[model samples]
Target: MRTKQDWEWLAAGSEYLAAVAVRELLQEGKSMEAYEGLAFLIESMGKSKKLALRSQLIRLMSHIIKWKCQPERRSSSWAITIDSARTEIEEIQEEVPILNRDYIESVWDKCFVRALREAQMEMGKKKCQIAALDWAEVFEEEYWFEED
Candidate 1:
């Protein structure tokens, strides 16, 4: 009596419910069903991980856009955020090896557009122009507070 809702739990990040469902299937000797459920769970978790990675990328890019647009108002807090997002993105990639640079590049344009809009709204500017971001500058460049 499997329905779409059975998979919805996994998609919604309900790992406990998913585990219980799989256990029940296994106990009933429905090995094939249990294996399929596990496969779906893996795919759902990968999507979740990739979404989190995208969020971090957007946050990092938005901060970089702000940093570029308003250089005069730079703060150490912003730098820390940028660093933290970069680290988290890297960690996600490490944890999920399938999500590599190609995946990041694939979503880069969409993430940049979201980031641009977010940065513009946050800056309270009705019209703020942000040039295209360089991949190396955004991910590779080090941003730090200068010693005064």
Candidate 2:
């Protein structure tokens, strides 16, 4: 029987090990311990998914801010990055339906603040004058790089 600390350490290092331990516990008829470990794994996976979504959101929002703030400096790569991030965020939400618009809305302010700060830093500006982003502006607005 592994201790709580053992499970935490194993999970932190490799989820595979934690999962294996849970399987072993089940085979040994330790149903209660196996259940607890499975629950922990589920919670950890959910946290990871949320973090992934937040990362994509931050990337998308920051690039959009940069595009708006520095139109003169915009390039194809920026447009591509913005597009990619949007696609990835949407894909994540689709795969994990629990992370829907409501979840995005829940973390909007914090993600925006982080994105704003990152954008300002990248653009070498101490402050950016951009306003808060609405869902439509971030996800629905068309941002394309038309080749001439």
Candidate 3:
């Protein structure tokens, strides 16, 4: 039987990681502090450094990481703490005076990658004659071809 627990934790991790990566990309040009897994968690989730954003990122990150977090928990890539995630999210939500194309491009790329990940999962789970979902990070560079 396919227990919910089997896919729950991994799915949560993947979702949060993808979201964080996208949020970081969105805030990349705005703040220098967000270069490495979000700076602090006081204000926002991304690079905003505002208390308001920090709070939200913390909440989202905490929800993603869940209660199973070990005391010295460490992901291969630095795990953005619940606090930091909130701060990062806030930074991304901030309005910039003008449109920054480069930053926008980065965010779009991240979002594209995320969407592909989600699509891959859906494509993998089929009723008749299941197939392997080869959506590993290795082929992340491939452009997604959609029928429209």
Candidate 4:
């Protein structure tokens, strides 16, 4: 199983390589022939990052929905899952700051929908009235912790 550390290292390496590839492409006169691989590499890396974040965001949102809709069922495991997802997203943003804003904005609605569906299924409810959470609330570490 690839642990969080392994994923972090892979993300860092991908970001570093993409930056180097772009720099070299610029130095080599910016010709497509000289940098075709770079485009593919960057695009692939971006997709991978997006998918990873998307999965985590969905999981996080689902847990948050569960907590809100069924507070009696909350447990340490759910809190940990929320924290883990938040950390992964933060790490991705730190590694690839350029993609942070657009990625979150583009994927938020889709993630919310998936999360809602998941929560409904898990809770055995045909319909849930939970609203889409604010992005800021989703990412806020304080929200993931149990209120004292």
Candidate 5:
């Protein structure tokens, strides 16, 4: 069977996350590790050459800003994006099979990492080795350096 629509769902997730950001207005955000991991995940998804990921990410970022500045926007924060790609985070949350943040984040994290790793490997095979090696070297070196 064909896969269910993932991007539309992710767009919804982004919308939800953005709303959360606005509601919490997290002054001190997640660790750099988390952010980097998430960025890696996003970039990996971007490599698919699919506009859905980019469009979704852009929409999500907007919501995050809205959530960050919710105090200023108040109720209008969640309605931050109205483009064709825009979907209500609340709507997405409702469709969530599991209604927990930790579970959703875990799934997102795993999917992101796996996608990135595979994408990197594919690039290496494509003579995108220079690009792939540069990325691999930095993290691997840092980890090895710390072992000394």
Candidate 6:
């Protein structure tokens, strides 16, 4: 099985190729074309990173909501899901160091909104009033579980 590190290397290679394409276009004096390629590459990278982070965030949020709304229904599986999401998010941040606190802050609310919708759907609730948890709470390992 390909490990996470292997996937990260592939992502890095893809980014490098995009950067090289932009650089070559600039050297050819194709300023407009270069700008277009560069912009597209940058936007594509940002969106990919955001989507990855958002998915993990949603998983974490959904589990937290489930844990809170139905404390009795909590299981080791829910805890594992939360832990796995946190680990994946950390790995993503390590790979793309630019996805720092500021980037998280910019995207957190939007992700949380989507997460809430997802949690409601998954939990079969008409409404889930759980507030967005703190960043540390969501990302910290073992934050929700007494034992994992």
Q: Which number leads on lDDT?
A: 2
Model 6 gets an lDDT of 0.76
As a TM-score, model 4 comes out at: 0.71
What's the true lDDT of residue 19 in model 1?
Answer: 70
- Using all chains and alpha carbons, the TM-scores for the candidates as numbered come to 0.90, 0.92, 0.22, 0.71, 0.21, 0.68
Model 1 score (lDDT): 0.87
How many residue pairs clash in model 3? 21
Candidate 3 C-alpha lDDT tens digits along 1-148:
2233422332344545534553665566633333322322211232332333334433433323221223233342323443344345535555532223344334434444443444335344223121222222211222222332
Task: Please write out the lDDT profile of model 1 over residues 1-148, one tens digit for every residue.
Answer: 5656667666466866777788999999998888878777777788789999999999999999998888888889999999999999999999998888899999999999999999999998876677679888789998887646
Which residues of candidate 2, in runs, are more than 4 Å off? none
Error of 2 at 9 (Å): 2.4
lDDT of candidate model 3 versus the reference: 0.35
- Runs in model 4 deviating more than 4 A are 1-34, 141-148
* Residues 1-148 of candidate 2: C-alpha lDDT, one tens digit per residue: 6677776777767788879989999999999999888877777777888999999999999999998899888889988998899889888888889999999999999999999999999999998889789888799998776655
lDDT score, candidate 4:
0.76
User: Model 4 residue 113 lDDT?
Assistant: 96
Worst 10 residues of 2 by lDDT: 1-10
- Runs of candidate 5 with Cα error greater than 4 angstroms are 1-49, 80-148
Runs off by more than 4 Å, candidate 1: 10-13
lDDT of 4 at 104: 85
Stretches off by above 4 angstroms in model 3 are 1-45, 48-99, 125-148
Tens-place lDDT per residue, model 5, 1-148, is: 1112433343235644433433343334544433433444454343332334333433443333333333243343244342222343334445442433444344444433444444445334332222212212211222111112
TM-score order of candidates, best first?
A: 2, 1, 4, 6, 3, 5
Clashing residue pairs found in predicted model 6: none
What's the count of clashing pairs in each model shown? 0, 0, 21, 0, 2, 0
